[model samples]
Target: MTKIANVRCQLVDLEPETARSDASQSFVKQETVLVTVETVDGMSGTGYSYTIGTGGTAVVAMLRDHLVDGLLGADARNVEQIWQRMVTGTRATTVGAITSLAMAAIDVALWDLRGQRADEPVWRLAGGAHDRLPLYDTEGGWIHLTCEELVRNALAAKAAGVRGVKVKVGKPSLTEDAERLAAVRDAVGPAFEIMVDANQCFTGAEAARRAHSYESLGIAWFEEPLPADDLAGHVRLAAATTVPIAVGESLYSSLRFAEYVAAGAAGIVQVDAARVGGITPWLKVAHTAESFNVPVAPHFLMELHASLACAVPNGMYVEHIPQLGAISRGGHVIEEGWIRPPESPGIGIDWDLDAIDNLRVA
Candidate 1:
């Protein structure tokens, strides 16, 4: 048995590729918590989770002060067992952001180890349901961008072969939001996909109103139109609109996703691997969404999500928001608007160790 010999955690602060803002918050930086788990035989794998700008230290502390000791001598291959142990040990913090993020770092690292030992990519290990996933640009559609800017970016993405671009909705008025989306729609034409994201900015009534307004535009989906915790509101909004309600990025557990899917609140599920705990639970959420015949277009972390999206049969699109350039070499190869998962073992991220060292803050 390859017993876990060492576990290390570090914090790296990375700036966003561009100044980004939506209805909810501004992304000032990515406070990433990186974890490395090494076995007694000298094999190692890396995993990470992030916050937009805060709580990175807490995530690190959770790993160092509570999680790492439990992993030091456990069977590294028994990922599910270790994951459950961590959840049980951190019972007080289970199903919350910091604990989930901490577990995610370790859980993904274990999956990485599994991939390396099996000599297969994480995608194949997870499911290998698809070889590639279509790409959509979210970086180009911040709420702060002007209508012209949104149009230009959508055109650029389309020209680059991207299938769609997400336009952030939640201007001061509904008409303003409509105008902005209309401009992008006019520029991209009807054939290209346009997804509108409210970023959890609207009330159920407001979300329903906007959904109705945007439905004529032929958007791919209305993303996060209401707060994630408001299941009843989402159900109401989803029922009231022809536009699909896409949620799950802010949900912290598979059970929460199951609730949304079961309630018919989520027409499209957008699970984030890091936020939902790790690859283990992430797969659970994906398969759960699949059982309901719902499509999953994951949230951020494109580098990690690329492989995960390909791993699932129901994955719809991978949102494009590159944020790893400062700590990694190369990036996802976007070929004709689709991203192919890296064929290498583990999670498929090509981490730049030197870059990570330079940015390490804890």
Candidate 2:
């Protein structure tokens, strides 16, 4: 057994092509806390935790303070035991927030180690349940792009062989939001699947009003129409709108999702592998969501979700955005509308050392 030798982490602040926005702060430079685990046998594994350009230092500190001590010198093969030691072992403080983020890094690293040791791809290790995961173009989300630009972008996705697309629609004015959504729907035609995300940028009444107008457009789903923490609001919106209510990215646990399911708040689940404490808990949430008859449509990290979407029956579309130039190495190739999972062992993607250098921000 290879004993765990060392653990180290870094914060990578990567700039986007332009300022990206919704009803909240708008900017590039997404902050990511990257974790690296090394073993006595010279094998090492890597993982990352995502944040909105802040909380990176805190995430790294949590791993250094709480995780490194318990993780080092342990058997790298005993992944579950180590994870439990770091998570449930600190029940009073470990159930949410920074701790979950820290666990995300450690969990992903272990899976990476397992894949390398077994000499198989992580997707295969996780059991390659399908050949490919479907893709959805998700960048036209109200980042100040015009309706024509939005339509052009949607058409480009179709031209690229993508079948579905999502756009943002919380402009404060319901009329303006409606027109933008309608324009895109008209451009994409009736058969193509178009999803709308409010990014928690509306009131329950506003959500219902906007959703009512959007229903005429044949949208595939309505995502985060209200703040994620507002269960009552979500329940109200879900009840009021004929459009399917979808959410889950802001939620930090499968436990949190349980409330959403019980309240009948969401019909679709958007589990983030990084956000839900990495692949382990994310799968747990997927299973739980399935039991509730809710479909899993993961948020961000398309490369990571490729295998995930393929592996679960209720798994829906994977959000496709090119944030990988920030830390990810080669993993998936988008051919037509399908995103292929990496065939390499453990997570299938590596950090491009050279690209990492260019992305450094003090």
**For this target, which candidate reaches the highest TM-score against the unseen true structure?**
1
How many clashes in candidate 2?
A: 1
Task: Evaluate model 2: give its lDDT.
Answer: 0.81
TM-score for each predicted model, relative to the true structure: 0.99, 0.94
Q: RMSD, each candidate, Å?
A: 0.8, 1.8
Among residues 3 or more apart in sequence or in different chains, the pairs in candidate 2 whose N, CA or C atoms overlap within 3 Å are 141-168
lDDT of 2 by residue, 1-362 (tens): 48999987877787774557776567556777777789999998887777776677788878877678888899988887887787766577656777778788888888888889999877777756666777898776554888888899999988888978888877868888788888888888999889988888888887888899988889889998888899999988888878899998888877888889888998899988888888788878888888988888898877678877777777778888767665666778789988887778888777887777676552
Q: Please give the range of 10 consecutive residues that has the lowest summed lDDT in model 1.
A: 325-334
Write the residue-wise lDDT of candidate 1 on 30-64 in tens digits: 99999999999999999999999999999999999
Query: What are the lDDT figures for the candidates, one per model?
Result: 0.92, 0.81
